[model samples]
Target: MTTHTPYGDDPSQYAELTLPDGAPRGVAVLVHGGFWKPEHDIEHAQPLVPSLVEAGWATWAIEYRRGTGAADTLADVRAAIAACPVEHPVRVAIGHSAGGHLAAWAATQQVGLTHVVSQAGVLDLRAAHDAGLGGGAVARFLGHPPGEADAGVDPIRQVPLAVPLWCVHGRADDVVPLAQSQAYVAAATAAGGAAELIEVAGDHFDVIDPASEAWARVLGLIEQLGRPAG
Candidate 1:
């Protein structure tokens, strides 16, 4: 069974917690992406919780206020992450699309996150704005063009993350181009950050589907990140 916990007074500031059958090896914080819109809620990520649980991991599927602005959305993500159980030895933040941007942005904060996985994330807000993704979604979220110096929220601008970053993007992703992940990973690596980009065969949604091969690869990356270094 899954339990829903409210992180804030707003109805959107809640998270669904799912536990494994046995002891959990770690906790996976799942953030859904819908170009930062209300239409895409945590329910879209529910299908992934069971798989994570079955993999011996506890899951926290977060729902945050969207379409408000980047600050509010980020605040909700931070609050939800803070609400997670800290006793878990390993913590990973997994997000798709806009959520991927949030996941990567969260890593920049001192949130005690061990790893971050961005699936088809719009890492480069500036580029995304220029590309006219989601019909000016970036400008709407940031309240201005990318040149306004909101590097704090822009994942690509905030390169060389403290935590290890795993960027998985579908080559055929029409929603968010593959170049977003590729460029971000390259910049992170160049800036002396630990990052890797995995190109998969699928679309933007395929990376989030629990049954898709892209999702299986995401699970594999999570497992790899959970392992202790020699």
Candidate 2:
């Protein structure tokens, strides 16, 4: 079973921590997706907790504030990360959709992570802005257009983060599109970052579904990424 704790005073600023049967090899910080909205809560990520715990990872799934503003949303994420218990040897973040963007952004911000997994993430804010993703989520997130936004906020723009990134995207996803991950990985690799793009067969949510092959691939990737404590 998973236990919950508050990282911040806000109800949304809580996290769920679950330990494995034996000593955990690492910690997997799970971030959920909702196009940066408050309506979508952390319940979506709860289903995958069992699989991660079964794989010997102490899962720390965070619930962050959103739709308030970019700074507050990111601030909540960073704070939640800071509050995470560092009892394991390795620590990695696995985020889905908008959470993936936050995970990548967190990596760039030097959150002391070993690696990052962006599962069908919205990595390119400029492109997403141009394409009008999530009904102008980038604009809502930045409170302005891409041209007026800062480069620090965009994951694809911030290539070569100190930590490596594994971008897993569903090829059949119409929500975020496979090109999002592909473009980000291409740019990161070109900039000398160990960013890899892994395409799986399914839609956006398939990457999070415990029974799906994409989810299995994601677990395998996380396992490979769990190197000796960095």
lDDT tens per residue, model 1, 1-230: 88989999998999988887767778899989988987778877888998888887888899999989988999999989889863576889999999999999988777778889999998999999999999999989988887857878999889899888999999999999999999999999999999999999999899988989999998998876553222
For model 1, the stretches where C-alpha displacement exceeds 4 angstroms are: 227-230
Candidate 2's C-alpha runs over 4 A off are: 227-230
Residues 88-129, model 2: lDDT tens digits: 557899999999999998886656677899999999998988
On lDDT, the candidate that comes out on top is 1
- Weakest 10 consecutive residues of candidate 1 by summed lDDT: 221-230
Go through the candidates in order and give each one's C-alpha lDDT: 0.88, 0.88
